[model samples]
Target chain A: MPLTSPDRTTGPLMVIGGAEDKLRKRTILKEFVSASGGADARIALIPTASSLGDEVVEVYDALFRRLGAGEVVPVRPQSREEAHDPDLVKAVGEATGVFMTGGNQLKLSAIICGTPLGDAIVEAHERGAVVGGTSAGASIQSSHMVAFGVGGATPKQRMTQVAAGLGLVKSAVIDQHFDQRNRYGRLLMIVAQSPQLLGIGVDEDTCALITVEEDADEVPHEVLRVIGRGSVTIFDPASIVSNAHEAKRSSPLLASGVLLHVLPAGAAYDLTTRTLVPQPAAIDPEDAAELAEAQRDMRQLARDIAAADASPAALRRRLARTRTKIGPNPDPLEGPVS
Target chain B: MPLTSPDRTTGPLMVIGGAEDKLRKRTILKEFVSASGGADARIALIPTASSLGDEVVEVYDALFRRLGAGEVVPVRPQSREEAHDPDLVKAVGEATGVFMTGGNQLKLSAIICGTPLGDAIVEAHERGAVVGGTSAGASIQSSHMVAFGVGGATPKQRMTQVAAGLGLVKSAVIDQHFDQRNRYGRLLMIVAQSPQLLGIGVDEDTCALITVEEDADEVPHEVLRVIGRGSVTIFDPASIVSNAHEAKRSSPLLASGVLLHVLPAGAAYDLTTRTLVPQPAAIDPEDAAELAEAQRDMRQLARDIAAADASPAALRRRLARTRTKIGPNPDPLEGPVS
Candidate 1:
C-alpha cells in the first residue's frame, strides 16, 4: 500500500539535512521563500530546536531580510501554554512559510507535539503553507523522529532511539547529517524495526523535496526530488526478510532484499513507481571530445614547456601561453571567454 | 556500463555471513560441498584467518566429514613463503571447494596475497571451483579489504582503513560481521573514497552466493542468491551523491541516493540488471489465514492458562485443552496434528 496522502492543499516539504548553505547559496531557504509566494511572502522562523535562542533568530532574521522576505517573524514559545499564545498562533496561521532550526530532535518533538503552535503549523500546512526544517528540524517533521542515540552501521538493539514528532510526513523517517554522521545504520535499524516506514537518510546540505500529488486510487502519490550538493540514501524495507526477531539483543541485524535507492542531484524519485525517474544522460559526445582534445593539447603544451624550463613558475607561464593558442571551440558556449 | 567481466572461468563465489550452522542443515556449508561436486568432492580448509588454528581445522574437518564430503584436508602456513608449499598448492588444485575460516581479515589477506597457495586458489577458481569464506575469511576475499578500524555509525577518514586483498572480487568491498559490529559505516567510507566499488555488508549467518555466469559481451553476468537465516546488505555507491571529497575530514559524510539491497534466504539479485529477481511471495492466503487464527487462539489460550495457573506445567496443560476448543484450521495442512 502507498503512503496515505496529506490533504490536497498541504504545501510540499523542503526537508533539509543539516549544515545548509546559510551563507552562500541558501538554495533551500530561497525555495522556502518561493514556496511561501516569493520575497514579499510572510514567513515565520521557529528557533525552538536551537539552544542558541536569540543569536539563532537574529541570524535567520538577517538572512530572510537579505533574501527580501517582506514579513519575517521570529517565534519562540517557552511552553505549550505560550505555544497557544494567540499572537504566536496568529503569526503561524498568517504565515506562508514556517522554518524550523536545527538542534536536539527530542527537544523539538517534545515542544511541538500537542502544542497549539504545532496544531497551528499543521493547519497552516493544510492551508498550503510550505514547512521546512534543517537537521533536528528535519527529523522532527517525520512521524517517528529519531530522538537521540549512539551511531553504528549495523542494526543492533538499542543502537537508536525514536520518539513521536509533528508527523508532517507520514510514510517516511528522515535523518539529517546522514553520511557525515554515519547515520545510515541508525536509520536502517529504525526501518528494520518499522518496515512500514521508508528510511530517508539525507546528507548534509541536501534537500529531500517531498511533493504530494492527487492520490491515484488507494495509492498515495508523493514525489521526492533530491536537491543540493549531497545525496539522499533511502532504505525501503517493505520486502525485507530477517531474523531480527530471533536474534540476540546484541546480534547484528539480518535483513534481506531491502530495496535501496540513491538519488543524486538532477534526480527525481516517484514513490508510486518505486523507481528513480530515468533522465537521459546529460554528457554530450561533442563536449567529451572537446575535453579529451583539450587534455591532449594541454599535455603537449606541458611537454614543450618542460623542454624549455622545468620550474613550477615556468610551467605556469607556458600554461598561460597555450590557453590562447588553442584553436576556436566548436560550440560558441565552449569558446574561450576572451 | 556494467561490471567488467573477468576473462576466466572464475567459479561463482559463495560469501557467507558469520555463524553459519555447522551442525544441522548446514545449508551454506553443504552448498559449498555440493558446489565442489557432491560427496566425492575434495575440499581444502585454510585456517590461517582463524586464531583458533588447529581447533578451527578440527571443527570444519569434522563438519565436512559429517556432511559426507570426501577428502577434507587442513592447511596452515605461518608465513607468505610457507604459503608457497607445493603440497598446499596440490591440495587446492585437487579441491572443488577451498574454504577460509573466520578470524582477523587482515591476517588472512596478509598471509594469502602473492603466495603460491593464493595463486593456486585463484587458478582453482578459474577452473570452476567454489571459494567460500565466513567472517574475517569473507572480508579477505575482496580486492580492498577493511583493515582494523573503530566501530561507529558515522563515516570518518580513519574510522575505516582499507588494505589490498587477494582481488578475488574486484567491484565490491566486503565487510564481515557487518550487522553485528556495526560495520556499515566502514564499508560506506570505503565506497565514498572509491565510488566505483560496491560495499557488500554480509549479515551474520547469511550467504551472498555471487555466481559469475558466462559473460555475454562486455557485461559481466553475476547472480547473487542469499542463503541462511540472515540477509545481506549491499551498498552500491555507483549513483551516490556524497561530499566526501569536499567536506572537511571530521565533517559528517554527505551521500545521497546510494543503492542498497538486503537479500534474504532464497532471494536473488542480478548484478547486470542492478535489480532483484522478483519472486512470488511464499505464504499463501490460506496459510496466512490459518496462522492468524492460530495466533488468535494462542492468545486466548494464554489468557486461559494465566487465569487457571501461572506455572509452566499448568500452562502446558491449558494449551493442550484449548487446541480442541479453537475452531477448525483454515487449511488441512495447518490443522492440529491430533
Candidate 2:
C-alpha cells in the first residue's frame, strides 16, 4: 500500500447496491451528493442501459437536485457513436460526480467499452470525481464483472458467468442487489474461479464507500465504510480451499475456508489487510474458550496457507481440503429463519 | 416462405433449455446427434462456458459415444487468444455437429464473441452442421441476448436489458430455464422494449428445432418445432401496446395484447407468419362462437396494426393500452402455491 500518498487526491468511489430508496429519505444518493462537493457538485448521468433514457434522466435529475446538487445534467449517447462525441467527453471531464442508471450492465459495456468518452470518465475519476451506480451500474464497476449469473444460495460450478467490465475496481468484483437476489452462491463461484480477487456482495439499499487514504509514508490504503440500511458481505477467495474446477459440471461445488466478513452499516474494513476494522469503543465479550479456539484456528490457517505448495490456483486445481480443520462447536450451516 | 429449396441441406439449430437428462433416456442430445448425420457425425464440443471443462467434455463425449456417434472431439480454448487459433477454427468449420456446454453464458461470449471461432461456428451451421447448446448455451443463440434483468411475475419498467448476441436467430430472443426461473416477466419486458422481435421462453429438458425451409416461391421461412418434455412459450409482442419506455424507472410496466402461445412437444411454429402451424392430424375446436371470437380478435389486431404508427418502439413511447382486449375472463393475479 502506498503510505497514504500525499499527492494523490482522487475522490472516493461510492458503489451503491441496488434498490436505494428514492421516495423516502434518499439516504444513499444524498451521501453520494454530499461527498461529491455538495451544492457545488456537477453530476453527469448515463442512462444508456435502459430503454427510457428520458424518463430515467428526469427521475435522477430531480432526486439529485432535491438532494442539493448544484447542477444535474444528463450525458446521453443516443448510439455507441455518440459515446465518442467531444462535447460529451468534455462534460464528463469537468463533472465532479457521475452516476449511471440501472438497466442492462452489458449495454453499458457495449457502448462504453472502447470509446473516447469512456476514457474521459476514467480520467475524471482518476482526478477527483466520485463515480456511482446501482444494480447493473454497480455490477459494471469491476474489471471482472458477473455479466449475468444464475440465482442460488448454494455454491455450484454453473452459478456464475463473468465478462469484461469497466475496470474501476481492479482488485474487487462488485455484486449489487446481493441479499435480495440471493447472489452469494454466484459470488462464491466467481471467487472460487479466481482466488486472487476479492468478492464484494452489496445488499439492497446498502452502499460501500471505498476511499483510498494515503498515509504519511504515501501508501494508499483503500478503506471501506458501510453506509445505508444493509451490510456488505466480503469474500476472500484467496483463503478458500476449493476444487470447483475439478468437480463435474453437474455436481455441487466443494469450497472450504473461504474467509468471510460481514460489515453492517456503520462498520468499516481494511481491504488490504482483509479484515474488519473494529468500530470505535466496540468491545469483545470475555469468552476465554471461544477466544482460545479462534487463536488456535488462526494459527493453523497461517501454517497451512504458508505451505510451499499452497498457491492461489492450487486450491481450485486440486481437491486438497484445508489442513485447518474446524474446531468443536462450529457455526450451524442453516441460519435462523423468520 | 421459401419455395421448397432442396439444394440447401443444412441441418437445423437445436436450442435446448436447462437440465436435459443424461442418466435416463438422453433424448435432447440424442436428437441433436441424429440430426447431425447420426453415427458418422463429427461432433465438436465447446465447453468454454463451463468452469469444469474437462468434466463437461467427458460427459458429452461419453454420451455421444454411447449414443453411437462415430467421432466426438473437444474444442478446448483456455483463453480468448486461443479462440482465434487456426486449428480450433478449422475444427469448428468442419464439424457435422457442435455443442456448447452449460455454465456461464458470458464466458462463452467472452471467449467466442468476436473471435474467428465464433464466425467459423456460424459458417459450419450454414453449411449443414447442427449446432446445439444447453442452458447458457441456449440463451446466446439470438441476435439480441437478455443480458440480465430483475425477477418478478408482474412486469416492471426495469425488468429487462438487452445486448448484442450471437445472431443465430436474427428476429428472435431466447430465454433458458424459462419456467424454472420464472422468467416470463423478464422476457415480457424484453419484448415490450422491442415489439418487433419475437420472445421465446424455453423450459428445462426442452429443445426447439429451428430450421429455415423454402416454399415453392423460393423465400426462406423459419419454422420452430418443439421436442423433449416441457413446453416452449412464444410471445409475439408486435401487437402489444406498451408503456415501458415512457414510464419512470420505479414504475411498474404496462403492456397489453402481447400474443402468447405455449406449445408442447410435437408442436410447430411458423416464425415468418407469426402463427402456430397445425400438427399433422390435429383438428380445430367445434365451438363456433369461440372460433368467431378468435377470428374477430385477429382481424381487429391486423386493422389496428395497419393503421400507421404501430412500430415496435411506438408501444414504448406512449401508454397506448392494447385495443384488442382479452376475451372472456382473465385469471386472478395471485397464483397457487405448492
Candidate 3:
C-alpha cells in the first residue's frame, strides 16, 4: 500500500470523544470553529446520529454562535430518503464546516452512510471545509466503525461487531469513551481479528484532530494531534501476532506485540508512518512570559514568608506593604532583598 | 531537570519482563549477550534477588557461555554484609556486563540497594558496561520501583506500594509481567499518586532496551526501544488529573488524561521528552532483499497456478518441469509467461 493515499481530503477533521466540555473550556469546539475560518465559519450541524430531536441541534447551534461562527445550518436527515434530499446536499456543500453530534453510531451510518448528503460532506471536505464530530460522530469518521461491544482488557472472540464508517480517516477503527468506559478490550479484539487496521480509542472530552501535512518529500501525510482534557490511544498492529483467526467463541485471543501509543494534548502522530512527530522547538511566547512572571511572584512570596517568620497574617501584611512601596507598575523581583 | 542527567550512567540497560523464554529462539538473551560485547564479554551475574541458590546463577552461566560469552562471575550476596564485600565489589567492577536475576524485588533492594557491590555495578555502568536484568531486575533499574501490587484496570487507593530503585531510569517506576498479570491498575495507581513519575509496564518475554543518542541540537536523549515477543507500556502522567491524595481505602482514584504508550519491538520512545520517537527512514538491506525475493516467488507461484488451471498436483508437476528446463540456479521469474 502507498504510504500516502489520495483517498483522503484536504480539509481538517475534529474527531472528538463524548461529553466534550460545553460549559467550561470548549477548547475542542473552539478549535473546530477556528479551523473552519474563525468568525466567517458557516457550519452545517448534522444531528442525525443524535436520537434527541431539535434540542441536540439547538445546543450545538448556540455553542457555534457563541464561539463566533458566522452561521449554523441544521441538516437533520431522519431517514435514508431524507438523506438523499438535494437541498440537504447543497447545504452541506456550501458549509465551511460540517459537524456530527453524539448518539447511536449505527443509526447515523444507516441513515447517511451512502446517501447524497454523505457524498456532499465528503466533497466539501475535499474543497477545504472542516469536518468535526463527537462520540458516535467520532466513530463514523473511520473506515470501520464499532457497532457495539463489550468492555474489558483481554481480546475475546465475538466480543464486538463492526460497521462501515465514512472512510475519512482510512484503515482505522475508532471507539469513543475509551478508558472511561473500559472499551480497551473491544478495540483490541477488533484490531486483533483484523491486524491490518489501526485501532484508535479516544477518551471522553478529547479530540483526535487530524490534518494533512506535507513532509520533506512533499508527500501529504495525515497527522493526528490530541486536544482537550483526555488522551487518544492508538493500537498499531502492523507487527502483531494473534490467535484471533482460530480462537473459539468467547475465548481470549492472544494479541501479543501490538504497538500502542497514548497521546495527550500537544502530541502529534503521523498516520502514514504510524510514528509520533516531534513537537516544535519554540515555546509559545505568551506562555513563556506568564511562566517567568509566575516565577518572579513565587520568589517574592517566599522572601516575604521568610521575613514574616512563617505567619500567614504577617506575610499577607508584608506583601501589602511591599505592593504599596513598589507602586502600580512594580516588578515583584524588585522587592526588598531581605 | 536536564534532558540528559549525569546521574544516569553511560551503559545500556536490557530491562526484561519476567518469564523470558530460555529455550526456543532466546532472542532477548541473545541480544543481551551481543550487547555485552559478544565473545569478549565477562558478565557479572547477581542472583541476590532469587530465593533459590546456585541454580539461578547456573541457568544464566550456561546460557551466556552457550551464547559465546567469555566468562560469567557470580556476584550472589545473601545479606547486606555480603553485599559490602570488597571481593564481590571488585568482581562486579571488573565485569563487562552486570545482570540481575528475577525474584523478590524488595529482598533485592534490602541486600544491595546501598551496598559496595551495588555501587560497583553503578560504576561499571558508568564506565560503559552493559547492565541487564529480568523481572525484579527490571524494577530495580528505575528510580521508583513497585514492591508489590494488586491487579485491575481502575486505579484505586492503596492498590500498590513503591520502593527506591538504583535510579538508572530517572523519575520512572517499572513493573514486570504487566498485562499478563493484570498489573495496569497498580502501575496506574503509582503514577496517579506521583504524577511526576513515568510508569512503565513490561509484558512477559519482552525487554525494554534503553540507549542514549545525541540529537541535532547536541542534546543527548535516552531512548527506550522495545525488543522480544511482547511490548513495553508507558504511562506518562505529565498532564494527569488525579484524586489519589484524598481517595479513601480501595476507592477508585481519578486518573484522567494520563498519556499511555504500548510499544512493540522496533518501536522507540524518547525517555527525556516522554514522547514516541520516529523510526529511521531506511529499511534494512537484508529485509528489502528478502521482501523482493518473496514477491517474485509469490508472483511465479500465481502464474504457475493459472497455467495449471487451479490444480495443485498439476501446478507441482509444472514447477518441476520448469525447474528442469531452466537448469539449476534459475530465476523463478524466468518461467514460461503462461
Q: Return the top candidate by DockQ.
A: 1
| Candidate 2 residue lDDT tens string, B52-77 | 98998999999999888888889988
lDDT of 1 at A295: 72
lDDT per residue as tens, model 3, B1-338: 34544334488988999888888899999998998988999899998899885998889999999998988999999999999898899899889999999999999899998888878877887888999999999999999999988766546689899999987778899999875776767898898899889888888898999988777886778889888876687877786655566555675555555665666666688888777786553355765786687677778767876877768797778768877986653454553221
Instruction: Give the poorly placed runs of model 3, Cα more than 4 Å off.
Output: A7-9, A281-338, B1-144, B147-162, B165-338
Model 1's interface RMSD = 5.5
* Per-candidate interface DockQ score: 0.20, 0.02, 0.05
Off by over 4 Å in 1: A2-8, A33-38, A157-162, A212-221, A242-254, A280-338, B1-84, B87-115, B122-136, B142-173, B177-199, B203-231, B235-338
- In angstroms, the error of model 1 at B50 is 11
- For model 1, report DockQ: 0.20
Q: Rank the candidates by DockQ, best first.
A: 1, 3, 2
Each prediction's TM-score versus the true structure: 0.61, 0.43, 0.52
Worst 10 residues of 3 chain B by lDDT: B329-338
Model 1 - which docking category? incorrect
Q: Rate the local accuracy (lDDT) of all candidates.
A: 0.76, 0.74, 0.82
TM-score of chain A of each: 0.81, 0.79, 0.83
Better of 1 and 3 by lDDT: 3
Residue-wise C-alpha lDDT for candidate 3, range A1-338, written one tens digit per residue:
35655434579989998999999899999999889887899899999988795999889999999999999999999999999999899899899999999999999999999899888887887888999899999999999999988776545689899999998888999999886777776898899888889998888888999988888887778899888776677887776666566565675555555666656666688898877777554355765786687688878767876877767798777667876987654455553221
